[model samples]
Target chain A: MPEITYREAIRHALAEELERDENVVVIGEEVAEYDGAYKVTEGLWKRFGDKRIVDTPISEAAFIGMGVGASMLGLRPVMELMFWSFATVAWDQIINNAGFVRYMSGGLINCPIVIRGPANGGTGVGATHSHTPENMLANIPGLKVVCPATAYDAKGLLKTAIRDNDPVMFLESTLLYGNLGEVPTEEYLIPLGVADVKREGTDITLIAHGGAVLTALKAAELLAAEHDISAEVVDLRSIRPLDEETILKSVRKTHRAVLIEENKPFCGVGAQISSMLMQKAFDDLDAPVLRISAIDAPAIYSPHLEAKQLPRPTDVIAKVLSIC
Target chain B: MPLLMDTAVTTPNFDTAPINQSLTSEDKLRFLRDMMRIRRFEQGALQQYSQGKIGGFLHVYIGQESVAVGTVSLMGANDHVITAYRDHGHALAVGMNMNECMAELLGKATGCSKGKGGSMHFFAPDKNYWGGHGIVGGQTPLGLGLAYGIKYKGLTGAALCFMGDGATNQGAWYESLNLASLWDLPVVYIIENNQYSMGTSLDRSSAFRSCLAERAAGFAIDWDTCNGEDIYEVRAKTQIAIDRAHKQSRPTVLEIDTYRYYGHSVADAKHKVYRSEEEIERYKQNHDPIRLWKARLISEGVLAEGKYDEMDAAAKAEADESIKFAEASPWPSEASISEDVYFEVDRQTIAGRTGKHFFND
Candidate 1:
């Protein structure tokens, strides 16, 4: 087994799927000749040719709809939206058609498509390109939303998403692309709607997803080493079907829960999880659940403001320590 | 021989006749029967809506029956079709049984969409009918993409995407048109220009009200405008467009100038508030295509007047049967609510990360 960066893992998964399945194709603006905006699809066009790895014109609605249509016709199309913020331009196809078609069709049609792109803030990409829309997509009933934290999870989850017989919104982080982890070379898949306990402890349970999961893991290690506080870290890989059993069971053991997310503090995935915990596992708790989230402001272009907006490991550690 | 002489006398110009016209007497009867089936089926739906048996926005395509009938007749079994809310006619024309469509309107378990998708979301995958999308201009880009898929898969089939004249004003329509033309996708974009977009006439909503075909030239694709009232002309134009799209891998837009006799939906009064009653009467008298065709059949001795009566009776009986079936059908069960949300898959286990390094075992 070899260690690979998150970006390389994504590229490897795409390249391998292209090699394994002739029906798999990638389409997006600059995904072909320019090697993708995030370089996750580099060298795909050369190996698969222009037909498989297509560089579409800058028309998100048309290209995304084309991906949906391709999925209906038995083609596994992985379309890139470049930035999650740009997804609004194709919301009609994504929400009304892609998300609803299978349910509306009564299982007659399966939309086996993947809309992959970078989501949330870290770089000073500003308000336009920094908002995390995972909560909005998670609210939709018929869609599966996956946000992987590490390189290994990215490759495995993406491979599973491509093969899954439903439309999936696979969210990646701009900051985590360069982060490295050991990814298996052999074919593998990660089933969605499952949670992974990154680090186990008994003090408090910290639940997070995507980039925030990494921060929680770091904070868990720091808590164990410094204050002898054994904190449990849970990575919620799938957002829609939030793996409530794992979170509830972990909270029952620790009796204290802290949710970490990169989105704004108000009306985020944190709020939904907090409400679910209160309703289902309130009797098992020792302290009220606390949520660590970004400040209620748009991500600014300034580095200082951007840094202040995101949830850091120190913030997660403080939240856990406060609960403990 | 005597047989050849008899055949020559009764050839009926079948070669020169349009695709719909080239059909045998049985096929023509079947087409007319399907049109009547849709008409009667929608009438039942309207009654249901008024009585509260059905809910949601119900858009009926009554007078514009020829567009769906004429165009879908030229499409093969493997071809795909997508359309806007006013879609019952298109659904029935594409071989969806009247009973299933009626059951769908009643929100029953036996509906085409399993009672999940009401009238506006009708889907018959077995017939290759994609959907009855509720959004006005939403299907344009999707239709083009389906066409792209067909071409990408090296299939000879084409996708027939139906939209109204009002949808042409949508930005997605323009973007999809540009992409379809640029890629030379095998798709026939049919504009069911029914003169009004929910009481706003095309003259008021569209700047270029004369014809949508001229506007399509900007996309560098050839377009044609046909008299949607005349099923023959619609059939001919659609045949030409479908042929060009499949053979040349070029997209074509056929703007069919049609009319809606009823209000936009069951909610509004059927009376003409915007247009005059006299204008409606004039269209009914001068351009009633179904009546005109029936008259032509009788005058040319192709079909006896008795045959017309028999077909009408059969159509009425079919409509009555559909209503009975729909009324008796049961609603969907509550247990199956979340069944089709997503395709379920088995879970996978991951190797836990040790505290040693980012990659090493």
Candidate 2:
């Protein structure tokens, strides 16, 4: 076992996949030579060469579509969108081509493509660069959306995504990339649809993912120490194929559910979770599902507004307390 | 093994000889039939749109039939092809069933995209035809990637990426062109310079009004410009481009200067503010490809006037049958509303069970 940062874990996964699969290649702006804007692909170019590690121009639509086309032709293309917000430039290819091509072709084609990038509000990147699009992508049908909180999970899930048949949207938060966790040295893959119950309790179930997962876990610890509330935390690793079983099971046992998300409150991942719970587990619930999310306004450039716009540990704790 | 199968078999590549010397009577007839089929099919699409049987942006490739027919005629089944929104002609020319294409235009479940994608989004992966993309210059890098895959897999296949003069102005086009040339990918970038990017003419929109092949020179790609209206010329030039691409393992650009009879889409009048009626008449009179090919066939005594009439009638009838099939096809069922949305495991079963327990428990 080795203690590694989330960024290093991702870099290791890329290196391993490139080493193992001759068909795997990476294409993105500044991915090669520059070693990625976030350094998640640091030192990959030297290992793989320029052919496998491509440095593309600022052409998101072309490169993303290139990934889709390459995947269709049996190459595993791992593309990086420098920032999550830049994905909008190629939304048509991702939504229409990469997402729907396999089903459109009647299972004749499988797009084994991984579009990985940093997402969410952090470090005052401003409104243009900062966006949490878990809910937006979850609305799409053919994409598998994965958001890992810890270094170990990042490595395992990314490996799974690169090997998966369908396209995977691997969302990483800038804030969590430096956080350390014990990652196994051997090869391992975390399945896409499974959720990990980080901590179990009986009073309330706190559901979160990506950076918010860590916030939820911290909130759970504080709730236990201060309010004597035993809060259960479930990290929804994959947003699209949400581990409904884990969330609902925990909610049923705890009789209270609170969803913590960094996106806007309206139509966020929190809303989808709450709706699913109400529709299926309404009778089992002892309390209504509470959702903690950022305010409705666009993320401001001001550090104070940016901080206020994201869900904090205190926000998750307060929501869990109110519901319980 | 069978007599019928042997007769159906044909050479995989275009002949290296000159077009007239290389093509047999059968080859000429097949090319003529393909061109006629696309022409009639697009004409029917236009009629259907006017009648409101089809909706959305309907871009018909009328005069540019030879480009698709000639270029695709040179390719094999293993080769990959991608193109922009004016894709019906290319799809049909590349051997997609006319009935399925019509069904797609009608947004029927039996369509290529299962009714999810309309005219601007036809896809036939089994045929190695990637799609009909609506976004300009969107498929360039995709085509390059396909070529990369072909080379990476050590397959003797190439990818043909098609775009319009309008799309050439897009930044993605330049990026893909640069990458393709830099990597020496097995790709042929074909520019269908129909002289218009929607309403703007090449002279007005492009800085250089000469051949687009000159633009390819800057990227160090082997380039050629041909008269797109002439099926023979297009076939000859494309063969050279495709051959150079495969042999050299490098990218080539073929600038096919062609024209469009209809407006940009079904909605616009064939002629409006952009070009004068005189210029339209000049193109129609001087460079009518189908008519020129028909005359050449008749002059060569390969086809009689009556036989040409019969081919026209046959094409019209086929187009008619396609429309009927498309009209009679079923719409996608509401039950499949969530289908093809994602490639997720069937968690619905567990979700449903847990959902029921959540309320009851």
Candidate 3:
């Protein structure tokens, strides 16, 4: 058990997967000589050399579609996007080629490709650069979207995503990249479509994912120390194959729930979870499932306004207080 | 599969490539028969479409048969192919059974894509045929990846990625072409330039001089153009590009002069609005790949008298049988609609058993 940043955990997962399978190649822009766009793939090219680690021009569609194509031939491709917001440029390749080809081809093709990058809006990268697209990708049926909130989950989930025989849309956070957590020295893999309860409580359930999980955890701490309200934190590590049982189980016990996320409130991941809870756990709930999300608007470029634009511990606390 | 389907203007196409000389009369005749099969198969599909047997967009390769048949005939075991929605030509050329292809058009359980892909997406992995992709220029990058796989695995093979004249305008294709040259990938981008992309003519859509593939010059890739009607010309030019890919691991942009007799797809009933009746008739009566190839063989004294009739009858009969097979086939089960969405879910792997893949009914 060694402490490492989320960035290191991701690099270790990539290194392990590359070592495990020679067919796995790292493909992206600025990944080779430039370390990486965000230093996530730092030192990988130095270790793997030119053949294993490839750098493409600044064209997301070409490389993303190429990864989809290469994956069909049994070569597992792990493609990196500098920011998931740029995925819009390559929407046809990302959604149509990588996401739907498996179903379209009747399983004759399996896109064992991972398109991962930083996706969130707290850094004031503007609407062009900042996007929280977990729910957007999760809307597609064939894709497996994961937003690991911690170093441990990042390592375990990414390793599985590379090896998994389906197309995986791995969502990472620029804000959480440097956050420290304990990751094991031994090799470990986490299965997709599972949820983790980050902290145990009984009064209310604060449901969150990706960077918003940290906000939920902070809210849980404040609720316990200040308000004396015991709040449970459920981190949805995977978005598509949503772990409804884990989420419902926590809500069933707490009898109160609040959903939090950085994505816009309209048709957000929280929207889907709320609908699911109402249908499945209507009798067990004591309060309506409340949601705290980024204000429904484009990510503002102003740094001062962006802090308020994204989800915060205070927002999660207010939602919890209103519901519980 | 050059500038397009009707760029059939006579030009002295150089057949200097040694590869074309290796083709025996038997090989040339087989190519003729393959092209004829595609042509007749498209005719039969037209009949099905008229009768409401097939569903969705039906992009038949009626006139551009030689482009798919000629280029696919050049593939070795390691070589692969991927093309646009106008794909029945390549599907048959690569050895996909007519029953499966027709069933796919009918949306039956016995389809090549198991009734999922329909006309715009036909795939045969066992035959090294990746798919009949729908989106314009989307298959280009996938083609690069297949070439990437060849290079990564240290295999001496090339990926033949096919597109239309309109696909040349796509930003993805330029990006793919740039990477194809920069990476020295073994990929030959074959444009089955049928002049019109859907209802839009090449003049209105793509901006290029000489041919659509001439734009490949910007990427530093070698380029070639040839008549699609003559199997020998298509084979010779494509063979050189394939050789460049296999031997030097270099990419090539080959524009094959071909035509599509019907509209861009069966859905474009207003196809007559753009192109003239005389223009369409001239192509069918004179430059039709099947007719042109047949006349070339008869003049060469290689084809037996009435042998063309015999081959054409057999192709028509095979196509007719496909209709019967499609009619006899069943629709995919209601429960099976959820299947094949994920490999793990279909295979019932450990991960598949754990979660709710379909969240809503």
Which candidate number would show the highest TM-score if scored against the true structure? 3
> Ten consecutive residues with minimal summed lDDT in candidate 3 chain A?
A315-324
The Cα error of candidate 3 at residue A284, in Å, is 0.3
What does candidate 3's lDDT look like per residue over A1-324, in tens digits? 799999999999999999999989998889988999889999999999999888888999898988889999999999999899999998999888888888888888888899999998888678998888888898888888999999999999999999889999999999999999999999999999899999999999999999999999998999999889999999999998889999999999999999999999989999999999999999999998899999888999897788998888888778777866
Residues A121-232 of candidate 2: C-alpha lDDT, one tens digit per residue? 8678788898888788877767878999999999999998898777889999889989999998889988777889999998989999999898899998999899999999
Q: What C-alpha lDDT values do all the predictions have?
A: 0.82, 0.82, 0.90
Q: Which wins on TM-score, candidate 1 or candidate 2?
A: 1
Where is model 1 more than 4 Å wrong at Cα? B1-21, B345-361
Residue-wise C-alpha lDDT for candidate 2, range B279-326, written one tens digit per residue? 667667767778867776777678888888899899999999999999
Distance from true position, residue B41, model 3, in Å? 1.0
Deviation of model 3 at B322, angstroms: 0.7
Q: Sorted by lDDT, highest first, which candidate order results? A: 3, 1, 2
Residue A232 accuracy (lDDT) in model 3: 93
lDDT of 3 by residue, B1-361 (tens): 2334355465555444578777789988998899888888889999999999888899988888888888898899889999988889999999998999999999999999889999999999999999999998889999998998898899999999999988888899999998999999999999887888889987888777787878999999999887887777888889989999989999999998777889988889988999899989988997888887888788888897689899999999999999999999999998878888888888999888766778873
Superposed on the true chain A, the predicted chain A of model 1 yields a TM-score of 0.97
Q: What TM-score fits each model?
A: 0.93, 0.89, 0.98
Choose the strongest candidate by lDDT: 3
DockQ for the candidate 2 complex?
Answer: 0.37
Q: State the lDDT of candidate 1 residue by residue for B106-159, as single tens digits.
A: 899888888898988888878889988888888888899789889899888889
